[model samples]
Target: MGQPPLEAEIEIAATPDEVWAAISNVAAMKKRSPELVVMRTFGKPKVGRRSVNINRRKGFAWPTTARITRWKPPTNDGGNGSFAFYVWPTDVEWSYDLEPSSTGTRVVERRTALPDPSLSVRLTAKWALGGADNHDTELLAGMNATLAALKVEVEQP
Candidate 1:
């Protein structure tokens, strides 16, 4: 509606599988995420698994539990490793994707199904922040930072 989805993509010097390892490991993610304060597993990490996500380090600090709505491991369709974590009833889908690239690999994050930028969106523009920026500015910056850090972490020999 407002925008198809909030997508941020960056190319990292690494392989697709290597990138997947970084995204798949919840423990590692918690440790590496600059803003991620805590991540606890409620069950196994699979298609039907669930986990609690606590985001901090910014002016905002909130904890939310999400279910693994999709667990896909690069099967055709661009063969980009993809997974979706749903916070439930919010219509928001936090998605991750990885694809091989000439430079090395490309990582993408799509925070889709966000509330269409409408009357309510304009009303809460100042108070609500979705993608790094309150109205989405430094989102790609953060995504790039994560991808760069991830590339460094994965490309180590």
Candidate 2:
């Protein structure tokens, strides 16, 4: 089987539009994301657009060129938000739902299983598992950290 998906949520003291603006910008993401050292794209990223995210400490790159599933603005209750981060071999889908309230906006990010990757999962089966180092656990932790940082950045001036 492919790698299991991870889910996380973070509340931001900002409107959905504000959060979207900050999160959508590749350059801006480099600053908001705790684990994402830097991200850049030759051009804009759309449905078939591609981008790269590099980890500073790991000194490794996790390249993903995913198609945008839902790019519509947030609904009254926050409904239309999802993206699939993919590597030719496999991909992870992240769907976000933001709900507005008196406090602020509640952003929920869900990492779901990739239906069928471009490549066979068997090729990297061994590396996919979370061994002693626990890559899977680490991924979730990183996601949480990134979301937390994002919340702070969006809420602050």
Candidate 3:
């Protein structure tokens, strides 16, 4: 069995479009996400676009490739939107959902539950990533931090 899905949510004092601008810009995400060290995308980001990313924890770093699977911008009337990407090596999907909230926008960052991870991924998680469970716990914390940073960025004057 694979790890369970993980999520974190934060309300930002900005419109859904503003939030979407921040989340959709993969380059800026490297600054907000604690684990993301580098993000290089090929061509404009949209459904089917691909990116290469470098993530780090402690002193260990790893490379991951992902393809954009979902890219729905917020409606002009401040409706809901979401962005998602399917990652290789781990066979997981990461997404950000934006919904209009009373204050502004509710942003939810999530990692899909991995029901079946490859043998290589499992071994790498055990040997290099301090086991799947521990890394997942850290990933949850990172998600929280990432959202907090995004909130600050979007709300800044």
lDDT of each: 0.67, 0.60, 0.91
Which pairs of residues have clashing backbones in candidate 1?
A: none
Q: What's the TM-score of every candidate structure?
A: 0.74, 0.71, 0.95
Ranking by TM-score: 3, 1, 2
> How many steric overlaps are in each model, in order?
0, 0, 0
Q: For residues 1-157, could you state the per-residue lDDT of candidate 3 as single tens digits?
A: 6899999999999999988888888899899988999989899999999999999988888999999999999984457989999999888999999999999999999999987788988887889889999999999999999999999999998
- What are the clashing pairs of model 2? none
The order by descending lDDT is 3, 1, 2
Flag regions of model 2 displaced more than 4 Å: 53-62, 75-87, 114-133
Q: Candidate 2, overall lDDT?
A: 0.60
On residues 59-150, what C-alpha lDDT tens digit does candidate 2 reach at each position?
43454444455454554335334434443435566656666756677777676764544443443333444231365577678778878888
| Candidate 2 residue 142 C-alpha distance from true site, Å | 0.9
Can you write out model 1's per-residue Cα lDDT over 1-157, one digit (the tens) per residue?
4434577777777777767777777767665556667777676677778888777645866676788877777644555888778764334777788888898778887777565555544444445555324444454455556666777788888
Clashes of 2: 0
